[model samples]
Target: MTRSDDESRRVYATQGLIDLLLERAAAADPARENVVLDATPAGEFDADLGVDPATPVLTHFYLPAGRAVSDVFGVDLGTPAGRGRARFLTHPQGPAELTRRDDLAGVVLLAVPPWGTETLTAFDRQGRRLPLTVLDAEPPVESLPE
Candidate 1:
């Protein structure tokens, strides 16, 4: 197969695995149901990119309840509840800034650490804490040189 075709297969497999894991985790905790799962520090990267690694840009995927947040809001991306809370500013441009994919099954929120610091906590609409099974933020080991 061509390299592109092989890569496509790998991507699909990886997504399948992520979906399966999320399903199981959500099943165990009703609070986690239909919520975004945040992976921050575990997802930090070098500052070589345009963004500051210390002010990590964390993202989570969730099905939108009624479009976007009305205004800037604070949220916990960490587990055990209150340990992590950060404020997020809604982009004036809206979701289109993130993805042009009309076929997307859910919305993706891009959140940056507060004051160049990291925190982890997640909450449902009712402001109740939700459990999260964070995935590694780094690239796959296979992508690295031996």
Candidate 2:
């Protein structure tokens, strides 16, 4: 069966989550940076995810360095039945204080109206959602040097 607009939106959100996870993992640790998108298990499907009923998408990003690091942020996205759920995990020690005047820590979440469009969301270590303004339109720059 063809996917619905809601289904497509959820898929887009989930994929965006996966991308963010990978980017963070790579920045936090180069060696342990990896992302896995697994098909949802038969009985583990949640109606709130907003995706296809037959296929549940589970994305996981492994960051070995982040295991013990404080002041870190973890994000996950899941889609079931065309709705998207975004989650943010913060380190116990909280985010590090900014030593530089230009330093900033924040998250941005965007949802396209009318459904079936790509949704964008971001978060900081504090699990707060940042506003998406025209100034934030530029794509994220690489955190690590090539």
Candidate 3:
């Protein structure tokens, strides 16, 4: 598929993921807090991430990482979708980026705590989990691709 086609798919997947998690949160406990991650430009990710900027990156990583990350909202409910909806747009399993990149300690994404502790647990393809910081919204960036 073309780059634009791929981007469109990723955007859909990211939005769908947010909607699903929020919906689930409203169901399990409407009063409960939920997280909404912001999918920003690839260039913005370069600054926040410790990984080598040379590695080709996508606008969204966590979502396309795999189903394992899809269910990040499952943290409180104890149920992960096991496959991220964006999995089709990117990698088959594990993180969208290389599992072990010298510049990266792990994947990085903008955390959005629409309501929550501002912290969430996400797992990689190997089932290895890590605590990712969830922000109130995505950080500002200078250049964004159209």
TM-score of each: 0.22, 0.24, 0.26
lDDT of each: 0.30, 0.32, 0.32
lDDT of 1 by residue, 20-138 (tens): 43444434332222233332332244223332244222333333333234233343222334322322222222331223321211222222222111222333333333333333343
**Model 3 lDDT tens row, 17-84:** 43445444445442322232334443344244432333223223232233455477434232234422
Query: Backbone clash tally for model 3?
Result: 8
Candidate 3's TM-score: 0.26
Native-referenced Cα lDDT, model 3: 0.32
* C-alpha root-mean-square deviation, each candidate: 16.2, 16.7, 14.8
lDDT of 2 at 30: 22
Query: What is the Cα root-mean-square deviation between model 1 and the actual structure?
Result: 16.2
lDDT of each residue in 1-146, candidate 2, tens digit only: 34453333332224454456534543544232222222332234333443244543433322233333423434222223333232322221223121222112232232222121223343333534432211111222225677
Worst 10 residues of 2 by lDDT: 132-141
Number of the top-ranking candidate, with TM-score as the measure: 3
